[model samples]
Target: MHVQLGVLGPVAAWDARGGVVGLRGPMHRAVLARLVVARRRVVPVTRLVEDLWEEPPADAVSAIRTFVAALRRALEPDRPPRARPRLLVTEGPGYALKAAEDSVDAWRFEHAVRAAGELPPAEAVRRLTEALSWWRGPAYADVPEAPWVRSERSRLIDVECRAVEGRAEAYLSLGASAEAVPALDAYVSEHPWRENAWHLLALALYRSGRQTDALSVVRRARRTLSDQVGIEPGPRLRRLETDLLRQADHLDPGPGGPAAQVWAQATAAYERAVPSDTRTRLESTAGLMRDLAVTGGGGLEAARRHRVAAVAAAEQLGDPEVTARVIGIYDVPAVWTRCDDEEQARWLVAAAERTLRTLPPDGHDAARCRLLATIAVESRGALPTDRPASGGQARALQAAGQAEQLARRLDDTSLLAFALNGVFMQSFQRAGLSPRRDAIGAETIAVAQRGGLVTYEVLGHLVRLQSRCAVSDFAGADRHAAAADRLAERYDLPLVTVFTTWYRALRTAMTQPPADAAAAYRQADAILDGAGMPGLRHGLLPLAELSVRLRHGLVPALDAQDDWGPYESWVRPLLLVEAGDTQAARDALRDIASPPRDLMFEAMWCLVARAATMTGDRDVMRRAATQLRPAAAELAGAQSGLLTFGPVAHHLQGLTAAGW
Candidate 1:
């Protein structure tokens, strides 16, 4: 329990008595090394076995267990001369080291990394400078080759990249771009494929008045990646390059930064290339590639090329709906670069309109029909509040209705299955917690089952919506929970695949208070642990926020800056839990409601308002009732089965009087 964990230098662990744990055995030690590197979590025994031996020996599990037992004994060394909990524990289905994470070196490194993100520029530099000092050599340096090692090595590189990025950011913040040169250069060199890294380096160089140097650095990076990966620099990165080149004076930030104009040109070019209507290999590939470029970590030029190709294919194939959906997808990146919000909205709405124009009177494919539905949903929901654009909500409503009609009429199983999902959205909007709404949701399930298209991505969405409904109506979300479990089991879906869906479901079950719902959460947490994605990890924030309060009996305050709040708050559906602080929760509701709209935000306000009043706050109770009256009214439509954990809705409900 008191072992000196060292992730700063070759990952060391020392016993309480100060003896070095000899992680020195040959292959067995290698297995231990992999486990240690991945500490506090399971490293699939099979994966470890694969690493220790190219072809695992016949008794691989037995051998792996033996190594684990040995590592545990060596690392733990019974401090009290009794069977104290070993340093490692058999967690879930895999072996895990239950080291008090703070005692581990990797945790120390992580602390440094985290501290940098929190501190002022000077403090960040100090923190990261210390963290970077912990790296003695490439991590797992002596660990023998193993399957887990490949992934672990990649993780180590990622950690290093973060440190570099942090240091560079801190330097930029402090007006010390010159100091960041070496770090950025080194990082860019090591991670030639990283667009974000390239962007920071360019920013550093340009900010330091090295315009030519900045431009040259980006050009070099693009060329290097091209030679290495057979791809051009990514769109975001290429935009940065153009930014560097277009600057009249690098020191003076010049002329409508290139991201918008270049992206527009790229987009318009693609749009011009393609025709309308129909899906093909080229069209799907192009859309997927551009989506990846927009939301993914891929090459920009390549994404542009794919977009152009998609456009050409769409035009050649002449599918109006395909062109529309592809354009709708483009709307996101367009806005990111400060493109006109109205312009993006116009393009999105246009897609739906065109889809409507071409959608067959009774087509079974449902591609255009579905796209029309999604466009309606996102466009209406995403409309910037600064200027309330007209017709988005109307279009969304119309599209939803039209899609419903088409889905219901199309009897083909696959198309019906797809169309049923659209109907679920439309019907959910029309009648919350009503039998009709639940029936539509159920039908979606039936269609999915009938079609045999119950991928977790599909099922997760369905279950999440159903779980929401279950919460709204105060019904057990168990059926939907069961459905999720079956889907996961049937497909072997990775934890992340259905993680948010499961999280929302569990949170809803917890809304009842003191009752742990199901063992599903353990499985859900396991999925998140393996995800290694920042955004996905953000989903755990609410659960973390709630679980810590319930377990510790800590009085939650109204302040938004809890330890986990920063990590999770930015995601959505604002939550206002009363950690014995009903006043704080009330205040929190006001904050959540005050910020913005989008169904997700409004939903959170409703929930927070509900919680605040329950804990005390009569005025909050009255206000909540006032706010929730309409919410309840709205709920009858879009949200049929009250999904309790839709934090925004809860906030709004909390604000309303129960009868209101």
Candidate 2:
């Protein structure tokens, strides 16, 4: 029998000719995500169901078979070489997909990452060059309902920084200094905190015979790192600087690879935003200009060049709110050249508050709404919810409504599209049905269809909303996720695409073994990487920490800085305990115990369950469980994005494995 496998980018099946195929119904998408992540290995039918339906129906087994059958047909559509290697396989108590390491996106990504690390300079460049070609955008952008697949996408994204570093290094090693500069610069621009890219960049410059320029680069990099995030360069980069100071090398270098395409895309975006002063053009340019304002070290001088053009464009655009919004993206990490987080915060707050106060009573209102929303989100902790003076939640809604109203008035698709996205974000903080969010999210799926809006931002909000609807009131998180995934794919926005899909798959996947969760984590990590938000970018802290604790024993340290310190301690230990390390979990629980603070209650109960599970201690675990039960109940209701409930419920089960 022909079997179809999907462990990379959706459960895909094709004949020898590479034609698109279909799969069976019910949980096909969920099953496809699993196969892609698992990469054709035999995943138990039970596991497939769990990855699909969180609380599965009695007919789950049949559902799995139906999905498998659909996959086979999809892969076997016009089989000539027979579907054996063309699709998936049925084996043991589960199914085995036939695609090899190179066939799946996950496998392809791992292969690329590995090749980049293992290959020599020339070959490394060659291998990575081949690898990057695989990313059309976010992995499996068309299929967004699978947690298993989505997690894999996140992992792929996390490696993006590393991959860029590796590629640039390879290019430099091959004496392609000038060619490597733009990519390295882009890397530095995106991750202000990461030092490796900076180090590589300085080296590229120094070797390229810009000794004076090289020294300046190092100084600027050092200043930015020190000022923001409160740390200095790690040892490795410092060593590179010492090397640069003493070094002398020939500067002849070759041209860039296809990453030129990316620079092209960014350039095109810049070009699109320029040559116009109308609100239509200005609104379009706003995000791109914000992109330009960022700083990357060398290559395209991406952030610098773009920011200059953006500034000029913003001036021409001349709407206060638009100016403020563009300025906000620039201001958040503002550094005319070097990064200054303190300065960034200063500008962000000033621009945000100023924009809020000066919002025109009757101007490009959609642009104004977007500006306000961006400010609130970017300056998140700085402006607490309890204090709404700086146009917090309530103001955001009013702004969104007004923006939508203006869009309707002007019949502007772009403005309306932006307004709709703002509505989605505003509703997350506020309650009730919002016309802007609802009309656009469900109604205008096609409008935001292929990255007409920012995919990551939209997915981040929509995922939460979808989960809210599925578990609390609405039908499912999948609809929002499904649309988001398509956009992520089209735009190559990884994590945002996955956020909507991960938790929905988790409902089913969570019931499986601890290893399954690890697999799930890997899948989720891939997409989260592409989301490009620092918070989502750094989310691995919790998932990985907990997964390890669950799978292995937690080794305590005399020092507080062991890999676990930076994370929320309560949450990690709970996942670990639930993963089955009850004793070690208890130790962590004892250490984490603090009287319940406002936000810590949810996290506190997680630890409590773990400790209680180890000793079969009822009182504390029960209390934590009872207190957490409502939250956990809420999670069971959740169908997508970062749910507190799944992990909480899992911990509760750890406390008392009986009911589970």
Model 2 CA deviation exceeding 4 Å by range? 1-346, 356-366, 379-413, 426-440, 443-483, 495-508, 526-532, 539-541, 544-633, 636-660
- Estimate the TM-score for candidate 1: 0.42
Mind giving the per-residue lDDT tens digits that candidate 1 earns over 370-394?
Answer: 5655454334323232222234555
Locate the minimum summed-lDDT window of 10 residues in model 1: 331-340
The C-alpha lDDT values of all candidates are 0.53, 0.52
Which 10 residues in a row give candidate 2 its minimum summed lDDT? 331-340
lDDT of 2 by residue, 476-496 (tens): 455555655665566554334
Cα deviation at 504, candidate 1, in Å, is: 9.5
TM-score (all chains, Cα) for each model: 0.42, 0.42
Over 4 Å off, model 1: 1-280, 284-368, 377-391, 426-436, 456-461, 464-476, 495-526, 529-540, 547-554, 557-603, 606-623, 627-660
